[model samples]
Target: MGRPVVHFEITGRDGQALRSFYTRLFDWQIDADNPMGYGMVAREGNTTEDGVGIGGGIAGMPEGEGGGYVTFYVSVPDVEATLTQVESLGGSRALGPEKISDDLVIGQFRDPEGNLIGVIQAMSQSA
Candidate 1:
């Protein structure tokens, strides 16, 4: 099966401004108490019970970074193996193979063309 684009993030110099803009433009519900100045966005009137929507976040840009960009996360079967493949294909790791939870691991990389992308591995029940 092909990897699926599962999530996205937008980073900006001003987290609150970005959040306000998006909330006004898209009517998204944003969580305000996130510790890292990140806001989680929920689509307005979304009815999916399985969390199937293309949910995303808005956050302050990395310190000293010149600008911000949007990043999409692709779901993969194995983060380490996929990162190896990414390297062999001339891509480079940008962030992690960090474990986010018991079931989820995520990583970010820069493609050959210098675009940032993310990969996620959600462990199966039997894993």
Candidate 2:
């Protein structure tokens, strides 16, 4: 199998407000923090009933302009191996193997087009 879009981040101007909107609108359970400006919410992309990846977005604030979302994540069976391939393929890594939950390891990277993407390996599959 090939590397798939596993995880993605939604960057916006008002992250907290967005989180609230999603939480109430989508019925998504959101765990939010003020200082961290991050939301732990279940995005439809990575999660399915059976088992899949998980991701959320960083809370953003309006910074002199309109708000928008940026950054996305990809799903990989193995983060280390995929990261190697990314480097070899001329992709740049922003962060990695950051443990988000018990079974989730996330790596942030940029593709050849300079588009940011995230790779997620759920613990259920990691084992």
Candidate 3:
């Protein structure tokens, strides 16, 4: 099967402000206890659902980074293998095969035209 765009992120200099704006604008549910300066956006009436309607986060930009950018993450079966494929296709690793949880690994890369893209590997239910 082909990879599917599974997630998205919006990074900015002010995470709280961004979170507030999005929450008000979309009526999303954003909690205040994001230790990483990241806010999870839960759509109304579907807060308990998993993988519904393009899940997203609002993140604070790292120090020295100029502005905000949006990134979309594609779901993959294997992050390391996808990184190799990205490199072979003239892309370059931009972030990591980093673990977000015991069941999720994520990575980012720059495409040939320098667009930042993300990939995620979600562990199987039987894993």
Candidate 4:
């Protein structure tokens, strides 16, 4: 089977303004109360197997730091292996197979033409 694109992100230098804009523009329910101030768009009933769409986040970078970009994350079985394959295919590693938590690992790469992409490996509980 093919890998699934599970999440997306839209980030810029001003996260608060971005969040507010998206909220008014799309009527999206976003929660950004955490320490990272990453606005997680509410999935509603969309997180279940019967759900209709994917979830995503909106974040802001500190001044002169965050470059504005939009990217989606593909769910793979192994972050390291996928990134290796990506490199073999002429892409280059941009970030991790870095573990974000006990159950999540993520990475990024730039394609041959320099399009940034993200990959993620989510460990199942049974693992």
Candidate 5:
């Protein structure tokens, strides 16, 4: 794992609209609905910095939920291991350390005060 968040999912409504707005506003070339509605937000393949990664996505909500809020994913070597550390460090798990792809793993968790955070690692380094 590279201890980086190369991809991010922008959870919200009107995926196309949000994609369009960002594309025009920031001139971001977003490939929305690329696969299974997992739209990609990036600038070419240059989504990495040094060794860190940066990426985002867009998805729908259940009519009434937390939308339009961008979540921050911190770099970590292993989501499962990191979650264990988080729990031991006075944090709690809010979501799974699920594998979104062979190269990506995401797990939502919260701090002692209920502030959400995430952990991600690349597949290449995962081996």
Candidate 6:
């Protein structure tokens, strides 16, 4: 089966301003209580009882990164292997199959046309 697009992120220069704009524009409720202050809008916050929409995060660019971009993450089985396949398919690694936590590994790559994309993998407990 093909991988599924799971999560998304919108990063900009001013996270609070972006969060305010989006919340006002869409009547969304964002929670930015995390250490990074990344505003996260849960899927249930936007989705219907039947589950219609994907969850996403809004945040500022890392310190000194002046610009921003929106990217969606595709769920994969093995992030490192997927990155290798991405390179083989003309896509170059942009970030990493880095472990964000014990359970989550994420990576980013630029497609042949230089469009950035993200991939995520759920680490197996047995690993």
Residue range 46-79, candidate 5, lDDT tens digits: 3446645466665655567766556778777778
lDDT of 2 by residue, 1-127 (tens): 6656644566577777777787788667776754575776665544678777566665675577546656666667777777888899999877786887787888877889877677788777764
Model 3 C-alpha lDDT per residue in residues 1-127, reported as the tens digit of each score: 7778877889889888998898889787776565675787654453445735767788888889969889999988888888999999999998889988899999999999999999998887223
- State which candidate has the highest lDDT: 6
Per-residue CA lDDT of model 4 for 1-127, tens digit only, reads 8888989989998899999999999888889999889999866744657777888999997678757889999988888988999999999999997988899999999999998899988888224
Leading candidate by TM-score: 6
- Give RMSD to native, each candidate: 3.0, 5.0, 3.2, 2.6, 3.6, 1.6
Mark the regions of model 2 whose C-alpha exceeds 4 Å error after superposition. 20-37, 40-58, 61-69
After superposition of all CA atoms, the RMSD between model 2 and the true structure is 5.0
C-alpha TM-score for every candidate: 0.83, 0.62, 0.84, 0.88, 0.72, 0.93
Error of 4 at 20 (Å): 0.6
* Each model's lDDT: 0.83, 0.71, 0.83, 0.88, 0.71, 0.91
Ten contiguous residues minimizing lDDT sum, candidate 6: 118-127
Comparing 5 and 6 on TM-score, the stronger one: 6
Clashes per model (N, Cα, C within 3 A): 0, 13, 0, 0, 6, 0
Cα lDDT of model 6 by residue, 12-72, tens digit: 9999999999999998899999998999989886987888899989999988986999999
Better of 5 and 6 by lDDT: 6
* Model 4 spans with C-alpha error above 4 angstroms: 45-50, 125-127
Which tens-of-lDDT digit does each residue in 23-119 have in candidate 1? Answer: 8997788786856767987554543687557777788887898678899999888898888889999999987799888988989999999999999
**In model 6, how many backbone clashes occur?**
0
Candidate 5, residue 78: Cα displacement in angstroms equals 1.1
Candidate 1: Cα lDDT at 95:
74
- Clashing pairs in model 1, backbone N/Cα/C closer than 3 A: none
Better of 3 and 4 by TM-score: 4
